[model samples]
Target chain A: MGNSKLYKGSLNTIILKLLDEEGKMYGYEITQKVKELSKGELNITEGALYPALHKLEAEGLLDVEVAKVDNRLRKYYKLTKQGEKETVNRLAELEDFIRSMQQLVNPDWSIQ
Target chain B: MAISKEEVIYIDNYLKFLGVKYMDIRLEILDHLASEFENIQEPTSLGDFLRTKRSFVKRYENQWQKAKHWAHQRALIKRIIGYFYKPNQLFIPICIGIFFGFNATLLPKSLIAISFCISLIVPQCIHFYIYYKPEGIYKNIQSAKYILSIMALPSIFMYLMGIMAPIIKESPTVFYAYWFFAMVFNIAGLQEVMTLKRQIVKTYSKLISN
Candidate 1:
């Protein structure tokens, strides 16, 4: 349930960051990647993933290529030029968020 | 146990309730879920399979609602921004064009050339601005049509004041050419406005169906 809220806010950034790291990925592959990375903590269901992909494509942030994979047509998404720039910006923001969370959790932690 | 065709129909209807209008995508997703049920070779009963499928469908429906809400909010923000930007985009250029074009006769040759250049540049700018911008195509075009109607007032004033009479008598062909061009621009603007209205209606209908 907590993961769902995080997924809602960070869906675009996560998709963008993944595409930035991997050249292109299919919908199922994306879900699997998120699950694997989060060690089963965050699961991206099909319902949540596809619409976000579509929205990002519409916004000119992502480009899609449909291809036949193992007798199934899969839509693969990759970062557009704008998406790449957006990924960098989103990553910095996420990093800042993580830093802030760390400060809040460990109030006496010293700066490295 | 095998799944019944009625279950597929039920799932489809549920998706329809969730506002998924793309038949192809909906069918594909349904098929995927059905196949996942079919893959279970063990002695699982139909009821258990359906229970699992129902949970999956519920999860999907919730997610779909969230995504739709997000897209709607974003589109709304874009529309608001486009509304404010539309006037500046349309009016500024047209005003510059009229300012320069009206004073062309009084100005020197170089100034006349500059005025004509401004006149040409302004229309082209309006064209590109309306054509390229992702938002407010319909609104901008309607506003342009209104502006064109206002523009006709000047020509009417010229006729009433006999300002165009000397030109009409001195060079009838040149006067006809100017009149023809004005009519064409007015028609073009009106046509653009009509087309945009059609597009807006089509887009809204699609949004509703989806």
Candidate 2:
């Protein structure tokens, strides 16, 4: 698992970015994707993921649809129009943060 | 292993403790988990299934907590809004009485006295409403503020009018009436102010304690 403290801040962005790419995903699938993308570096527990998803859904940022997948009804969440817009904004914010961090770490280095 | 009913009840109580009030939502979650467990056709240990279910419940509980918090906040706001109006029902009659009382010269003295009687009844009615009707702390606090505002309006109007125009000629009777009205106004205003202060202190203390 990635640093719990660092993961706390970035989890929402990570979820949004994933939904932006994948279109729609179930709870379990989201957990798997995060692990795969991070090469198992970041392991999101069910405890954290569900609450974030529900909160985002409540805030009108995400829309949910439940359907039977392999005879079991699975709740899938997709980014709403608002969610998509939020994703772009969050991504830009994260990118800017990363750039600033890089500058701080290597003050002598300059981007080409 | 088949999931027992007791396990389901345990889960239900846990969710309730976490503030999940909707029965249908809780049942839906339980059904989903039960189905997942049923799908494991091969004999699996109850302990393993319980472990897996625990993880699932934990994930969903996080979402429930956020949603519940939002709901609780919305409820508090609604209760406060309700309080603003609960006391206004009393203030209206008092206002009408004061208006007609001041204009008694244009009407019968009996009518003015009747209006005063109605005004007195209104405050008692308000007291009954405040006591009998159960309200949340936020709502009670808000009602107190509303009552204060209502009390201030008449005094403010009378004070301004008295300063601008000496409606009643300077006499001992008129002076006594003026002092009496001023006392009533002050008492009503102070009652509301004190109530509001009490509510504010209680609310702040609750927030701090939490």
Candidate 3:
């Protein structure tokens, strides 16, 4: 697990992967999920989470659904067809990058 | 975790006080805060909670607002495209085709005026008509000044296109092209407003009903 500065670039990929698994999620739920999944190591800040969600929504990769849940409007986001395709691509790309980084950082480990 | 109506209202006001002017963004932020409040030991008093959030929001101020502006712009564009491409509107492009196909050059001043009126003026008049009502359609719609700014775009585009209308001395191609562009701009802008109105009418009512 990397620091937030390192995690910043991969936030979108993490979000998309989460959505792929979870079906639909709202802002706070997403932050909590990320924290829980990372064992409280990766806290998706409120500032970072909503803005990224909004950016994704604008990209047409995500679709928004607003429902009045208990008299409060809760906006849920789900991956569109394009977003679903994007998630697979992003995850593959992330995996490739991780593999490359590991090989670079631990070349001696592999030799042993 | 049952968010009450009062909490919802408080969150809405807090976002506003937090300098969130964009209503669409506010809605998302409101829901977020409410959800977080549900998790905390006590959310009834958010004064202390806000101190921590102040820094989080500060981190996002510039980037979040920039993204929101782009999102709104993209939304307006999507609305315009949606308006221009209803299956029934295939004739619109065909009309543009005829202008070029017929080599229409020596158009009368009245024809230009009529096109300007029908395309640019009428649709905006319709926009204002719906806008002035007590129950305006689109929830995302802002003040008149902002709406005017958005509404001004197609109008300005047409004005620039029309400038070419009088300059053309030889071929009517340029003249007709100007008319075509102007007409499209007005109708497309109008259709965008109309589509928003329709969505609001259809969707907003259902929200309350449900």
Candidate 4:
């Protein structure tokens, strides 16, 4: 498992990227998806996932729909039009960040 | 491994006991907890699962409460500003501004006081109604109350500043500014109330119907 602190900065971008790919996802599904994708290396705590979701929703970058799934109400979040646009921008920014980190940590690692 | 409705309610009660009292947050937490329980490969009692997950639940509830405080403030401001830019939503605020402008000179003190009272009281009434309503989705939603209080703030401020009445009477500029702000805020508040009601109704309509 990677250090969680190392993943913290990219969490929102990661979520946006996931939603961009998945269309819509609920809270539990999102955490599980992240864990599965990272092979359990990056566990998104419910504490972190939900606040990020709520912040994005507040920013109008995400939209939510509530549905009765099984015996409970589930809030499913998806990218809004703005969110979709933001995902592209955020992904690009994260890519730039990764390249910068790679250059700083591994001088021999050349992407070009 | 699907959780039963009874188990869902039990989880909700446990969350409440853990200080996650807001219905909306509690509902979301309950769903997450239920999902975790559903994923368990081995048969486990609800009590055991809750005991194991108590720390996580407490952590989330605390973080959510903090995040919600800021999110509520930001969303309220965003919605209020967003309301004016939408063409369809422009009508009510325009009418309010026009009405106040037309009546500015002729409007008596009693009428102004009454207007302020209405603006102050209406949002509160809506909040109280929803908060106390049986099975109302917003009954325990803290954001609803937070938004309503924000909506009422302008009225409360203007009312308290009735001390400005003497100054307002002497300066038409001040009076105009006062009425303009009052008109804008009251109209925005009304719009927020409508939006909040629409959201609650739309989000929970299925549950209501069931």
Q: Estimate, for each residue in B43-126, the C-alpha lDDT of model 3 and write its tens digit.
A: 357666655676665555466656545554565666546546777767777776675454435557666556545655676676
**A6-111, model 1: which lDDT tens digit per residue?**
5588888999999999999877678778988988888887667777886786576887564543323345689999899989999899778777877888968723
By summed lDDT, the worst window of 10 consecutive residues in model 1 chain B runs over: B140-149
Best by lDDT: 4
Find the candidate with the highest TM-score and give its number. Answer: 4
lDDT of 3 at A94: 89
Instruction: Write the candidate numbers in order of decreasing TM-score.
Output: 4, 3, 2, 1
Computed on C-alpha atoms, the DockQ of candidate 1 is 0.07
TM-score of 2: 0.47
lDDT of 2 by residue, B116-205 (tens): 445444553453355345753434222233333434333553445447335434553563365445434444544544464465555334
Candidate 1: tens digits of C-alpha lDDT, residues B1-210: 434667666656765665554443454455555545555778765456655655555565444445434443344334434433687445533554465456654777566545444543454445445545576433322222332332332234334325655774577466444543443343344344355446445543332243
Q: What is the lDDT of residue B87 in candidate 4?
A: 81
CA deviation > 4 Å runs, candidate 2: A108-112, B1-47, B52-210
Docking class of 4: medium
lDDT of each residue in A47-70, candidate 4, tens digit only: 788889877886778998878888
Could you give the CAPRI-style class of model 3? Answer: medium
- Mark the regions of model 3 whose C-alpha exceeds 4 Å error after superposition: A108-112, B1-5, B13-26, B41-44, B54-90, B99-110, B113-118, B132-134, B137-153, B159-171, B206-210
Native-contact fraction for each model? 0.07, 0.25, 0.78, 0.75
Give the clashing pairs for model 1: none
List pairs with backbone clashes in candidate 2: A46-B59, A51-B63
